[model samples]
Target chain A: MFRAGEVDALIHLGVMHDPRARPAEIYSWNITGTTKLLEYCQAYRVPKVVLLSSANVYGPRPDNPQFLTEDAPLLAAQRFPQMRDLVEIDHLVSTFLWRAQGVETVILRPVHIVGPVHNAPSNYLRIPRPPVLLGFDPMVQLIHYQDTADAIVAALAPGRRGIYNIVGPGEVPLSAVLRELGREPVQIPHPVARPILSLAFRLGISSFPVAELDFIRYVCMVDGRRAGAELGFRPRFGLRETIHAVDEPA
Target chain B: MHTAGVGLLDRLHKLRGQVPDDDIAGRTQALVVRGNEFAMRVARWLYRNYFRASAFGIEHVPATGRVLFVANHAGQLPFDALVICAACFLEPPTPRLVRSMVEYFVPTVPFASYLFARWGQITGTPENCRRLLAAEEAVLVFPEGARGISKSFARRYQLGEFGTGFMRLALEMRAPIVPIAVIGAEEQAPAVNIKPLARLLGAPSFPVVPYPPFVPLVPLPVKYRLYFGEPMTMTGDPDDDDDVLDEKARIVKSRIQSMIHVGLREREHVFW
Candidate 1:
């Protein structure tokens, strides 16, 4: 499709489906591939380009009590699989288009995009039961699928050039998400967890990649106030709504 | 007049059969092979650990052979040379073949000498230099020589006066000189102060003192970084006068100094 010019814009999704994947591998696909595609688009003179990146690019940095802004430095260096890759891809796209190609690039970095369509087995729903009840205590910012789609559509409008962090209605602790799913939570010590994860990694059964373990230990949260103010991106569903919807039948 | 003529005639007769003996040729061959093996092992290890070593403007090294690696010398340790060798070996196309000009003192040690000799590392002698270049081998030379290694810690990376011999050799051999600027070596041995006894013993250009106190003992894992600048092609005619050679040498030295400065500026903190 890219070679034939059948595509006007390319939405690079499908990076995190494999949780056991390496950070470099994810970076190559999502970030490097996106940059190459953008270069191709620029070469072919495609005017509008849209990239679906992760708000994890902000990294698991300490939140300022105040809401995070898009102007904040995308966490360029992190131990997370997708975070560093996303930041690099974001930079590569933004710099290439703005500096070299002059193509209008709109980047949407959404945090923990969630909704009913998230059927992937490894989605937060499938995490081992123990952590659910204990409430992992990790602060999370998420967006509903409808809001995600809306943010993607909004980028299509005129003058959406740089990056915007698309976050959900509000932040919630990790334990809350797991508790909502009705699973027991266990606090595995890091030393024990690391070796077990490494062994599982060696055996090739554990869904968690080593890089993901880094993020589990270190939290990442982004402020989407810029996305709200500029793109009018308002999450249609909050944590309560997600819980209710998940509980309800199709 | 009769005595002088007799002496001259005797010298001429002795010069007739001046070919290198079989033992010497065999020794040279053995040295080259050993050197090759040592270089290969070091290169492979560095490749696994810190290979590619972050290079910028490698286009400066000419694609062709007979290029000279002129770099700064820091401390008595040969880390800079080892790094350069490793970096060149790991370069894209792999400059696996480099003949570093080592000090004659290096070969005095049994194991190190054997390795250096095997790698075709020649003493920075004019004869050996010409022979190596004539054989089309890449020669690495530190023009600052002993002066560079003996400098105070505060003056590290600030190149001392480059010895003119490397320039003269390059001009004579008609080789392109590649200026290399290396960082992370000075910190490898933060010379607190040189002991007077070591200097008196002539311990590797002594008194100035060079040894990383924490390493090898406590094994402080100091991060090492190296940079290679663009090759500054010798512009003047090879047959140029001594003045021309001096001028070319100064230019090469200045280029190397600038590259080192750039590397130092770009780095956040030197030690660590």
Candidate 2:
């Protein structure tokens, strides 16, 4: 599909298809596969490209501040191997598209993308505990799935290039989100939760990789000002509305 | 101490019995004496003032006997090693003074080598390594070697490929490897700019080189924190092959890298 000359822009989705594979394997598929596709784009002289990268690239930042900007360094030491791989793939795609090929590449590091069709298991929702609250002080930045899709469409428009961190209208605590869903969650200290998570990985009951644990302590809070200012993006839903956007009907 | 105050010629003759004429120790001692006066003055000043460097996890450093102090290399500066030497040798109740064997190029410069030799620093040769370890003396080696110092500024904290010689020596001598992380060395010179032309002319980089600001200026007030991780003992079989030795070296290197990262994360600021 990427090689077809008729396609002006190649949007490489299907990256999160397999969550069970080791983080390295999943990353190889995203990063290596994207490299090959980018090579094809260069050979074909494709003028524009948009890659779907995760906001998890920001990793965990403090919840008190509750906003992560694009300028934040990508934290690669987190416990989730997949998240780390996604972060690496984002760098690879951005570097190849912007630096190597000189073709316009727009990267979207969206936070906790959610929507009605988002049946795929996500860290934000599938967390083992009910309330899913971060320890004592936790901050979370999220984006509605519809808004994420719209941002993609906006980037696909003519003559748009650069990186953007997309998030919903506001930030919320994991516990707050869980409360909105009417489920009380157990608040476990990261130190305590980390070992349990590691045991899960060992027992093959959970897919969380060791690297992903780095964020459980630091909550990534990014600024969405650029996405709104430059891309003319205005999230249509707030945290409460977006939480319910994906909540299954009773 | 008063038993032997021999002339230079007499000392040269006396050394023949203990060290062969072709051996490098004679030359090393001569170099040490050449710079002995200046090194003492500097060492005294460093000890009296600005020697406030404190170490965490000092227990990680072996209390006695043979040990390997493996650490990260930050550019061409020897300040980091000097600080380590001062802390270990000059501090109160010094626990088993150490000798750091550095690269051959370090002793190439007349003044630099003299001070280095006077302070018990030696060339990092295989023979010197075996001799030092055999004496059960603590030895310091930057396994990353020259590449670690020569790497571009952008690669800071990302360790370069480590040479396996240190690990081999440790295994051969059955010594414990103590990983040390020295924060703030990178900020001392900062390497803000590199001058390739000056380098070809045998001159140091133009601005912000790794050495002290001026060839004569003392180090500025940048705070340094050295963290030592628990010693990792080589448990590999004595008859392990080269591949095994290389793997052991990598494991040691990774542990050092982790200690460095942890130290950096714990620090509030490197420049303070």
Candidate 3:
């Protein structure tokens, strides 16, 4: 519905992450659909475009530094092949950001967005007894879904182009977040958790892929100083509020 | 939709419990305070009765501001780190934390993963060190890294080849480097490293002490003497040549080496 000189900004937030959806379907919607949308934006002379990317593009790595900057490589797809779609979409938008002469592309990679949302982190927290890998409690960063929305709105400001890691209240250990939510996590050994999760996924009992277990095992936090400096964005939520947002009713 | 979210936040803010208004670092420090208190009690017990550790030149550690405590690393385990941490907590003008750079593999371990971070220990990364230093916090580094820790018993008190990372960070952040000489840790677990075995086991080093329980799990109770040298400040390009960085690093290394010699001469026995 884009008419030339009419649409001021095109905020692209459409990306598929349905665990049940086929990879082919996900690729079509996330890649092909985004390509068409970017093409349309370019043809229609949209001045600004904000893409909602994720800090998971860096991947939950055991060797990751406490805080990853924006310049860090997007290597999420190295281990988990399923993450290729999101990584590809990020690469596509970033390429478009540099190539598109007129369109101002802003890529915001926020950390795990919690709150009254049906995302992986929030949904995992919602579980009364989430499965935690035994002996591995990595520090995790979370942004309230509202805070994430605020970051997008901040990016919509004119001249705020380039990538930014939108952090929230702050980081805490996985156990601390679980304690705040009053979750009694079932500790599973890392070696056996994979086969069990894989079988459970095959049996249609669990939606979490075996590859996704690394989220609870390794750290993938990011530094948000750039966002704070450039976009003038900061989360209004406290750490306790951010962690408790998962339990808030939708 | 935006209004609803804001309203919900405002409502939650009103009904807030005793949630501490602090960022991650502050929250982690709060946890560290609690954890440090308990750890200090135990560490003090070990320092006084068990190891009989004596900390000298404690006044060199500044009561405030960011400082880099560069020390010698030894003991099959990190009792040296513990003793250094305990020394800072116990003997400083005001009890302060000496945040040590833990190994990357620590995150994979169970209790140690989060406990180390809670107690203000961080993974050994330039970014982590730079951030902590900028925040005006003290950080501890062992430039010898694994090589110094897993050295054979024959090489006790001999300084390993120091890496130049900490020197660059020290110069970049403008934080003074406090050279620490931890004597006794080198002799705590006098084990020989079997490189082939370490490779087969996919471990850092395979150390086997001469005594029973050859793994060096429980260190022999040796007296720990920590000498804190005067804080040294170097000014130069942090991204300078490796040779330039190494030259500065050698200065710190030699300082620690000389302190270690003095400490060795002063001690009458290992288990005093």
Candidate 4:
């Protein structure tokens, strides 16, 4: 499909993130697939490219500031091996962005995309009784899937190119979000919950990976000012509506 | 269990009614709004009856600008931070919600993780401090950090080596630093730190008081006298040399140290 000047833009959203999937399969699909896509875009001279990357590349760290800028280092893969493919893909695209000067590559790192999706945050919220780390309720940021779509659309505009952290309306405590959704959270001690969650994942009883426990335990929020200033992007969903989006019929 | 959440709401609403118009200006959430209401109630009681805390020079804290309240931290627990927050909230002409920076380990702790954020506490990151200051909000920072909080009883009232991070933040944000000296917090729990025990537990500092229950979980009800000094406006490059930053930090440290001495002299009794 690489006819010169045939494709104006390429939107790369083909990252596979199945925590239960074999690591080799995920690596090939994510890394090799992104490499091939970027090669095609570069060869085809695709004028614009928008890559959908989650803000989770920064990882949920105990020392992270409440709002991380776009320039913050991607350190999620350090602790969670499952995140390696995603982080590697991000690095690959970022390298392409710098080298392929002809291509306007835009990376949209949206915080926890919820709303009518089968993603982890949405799926976790859908649970009637989600297991919460006992006493750990970090402030969480979520972006509606539709709002994420809006951000991608914004990035497609002419002259929009750098990494952007697309945020939703606002941030709220995880417990408050659960309360708003009316979900009863089972409090499990951190030390024991890890083993139980790991066992559950192995038995195919739960889809959540053990490493993802950090999401509920620490703050991994980002600053969306760059998106607002550059892309003129603002979330259309309110905090209440965004949290309630998981319950919306898919 | 469901009714318990309702009971908590009822109490929170009653507490909300008692506090002045809430002033969490920027980046607020539902929990923070409600949490401030509850914290205000607890802070009032602790300031008045529990600690009998007296706050002076609270007027130095600007009502409508970004300000950093640099205070001397003490007590095995962080009752010192609580008392300083209480002083800023209750004594100021207009109630200000001080977003104090907390320790990294705080987020790992169960209830403290979210509860601290809800009550306007943030992790001690320069970025978090910069953002809060940029939004014209009040932030409380303990330059002494862990060193000051975990000081043993023998070294109580003697200031620890101040960290230079807050000075850089104040300089970068151009926010005035209001030095605070909190007397009586050092006497709240006179304890010695067992380093080996702390290392074995993988905790910061293992403090053991000479009283019943050993661990200084509940601080003694000693009088908390908060001396808020004039706001010091620092002018320099935030990225200056460490020695340069240290010299400037020493100025604020000495200011707080002098205030602590004055507070100690004015006090007649530790409990009163």
Judging by TM-score against the true structure, name the best candidate.
4
CA RMSD (A), model 4: 5.1
Fnat across every predicted model, in order: 0.00, 0.00, 0.60, 0.73
Error of 3 at A72 (Å): 2.5
Model 3 CA lDDT for position A19? 81
Weakest 10 consecutive residues of candidate 2 chain B by summed lDDT: B1-10
List, residue by residue over A1-250, the lDDT tens digit for candidate 1. Answer: 5567755566656444455566567656775677677778777767678888776666653222123456666653554543555567778776865675456688888876665554321254555553221112344666667778888888877666778888876765454566656766676755466677678868976555555544443345666778778877788875666543443443
TM accuracy, model 4:
0.92
Worst 10-residue lDDT window for candidate 1 chain A reads A130-139
Say which docking band candidate 4 falls in: medium
lDDT of 2 by residue, B193-248 (tens): 45685487564433354564433234554566777788888876645787887888
Model 3 misplaced regions, further than 4 Å = A2-5, A236-241, A248-250, B1-32
The parts of candidate 4 lying over 4 Å away from their true place are A3-5, B1-31
TM-score pick, better of 1 and 4: 4
List residue ranges in candidate 2 displaced over 4 A: A1-4, A16-19, A22-24, A61-66, A77-80, A100-102, A117-135, A210-216, B1-272
Given candidate 4, what's the lDDT at residue B10? Answer: 50
Model 2 per-residue lDDT tens digits across residues A14-51:
56545566666776777678778888888787877888
Q: lDDT (0-100) at residue B77 of candidate 2?
A: 64
Worst 10 residues of 3 chain A by lDDT: A1-10
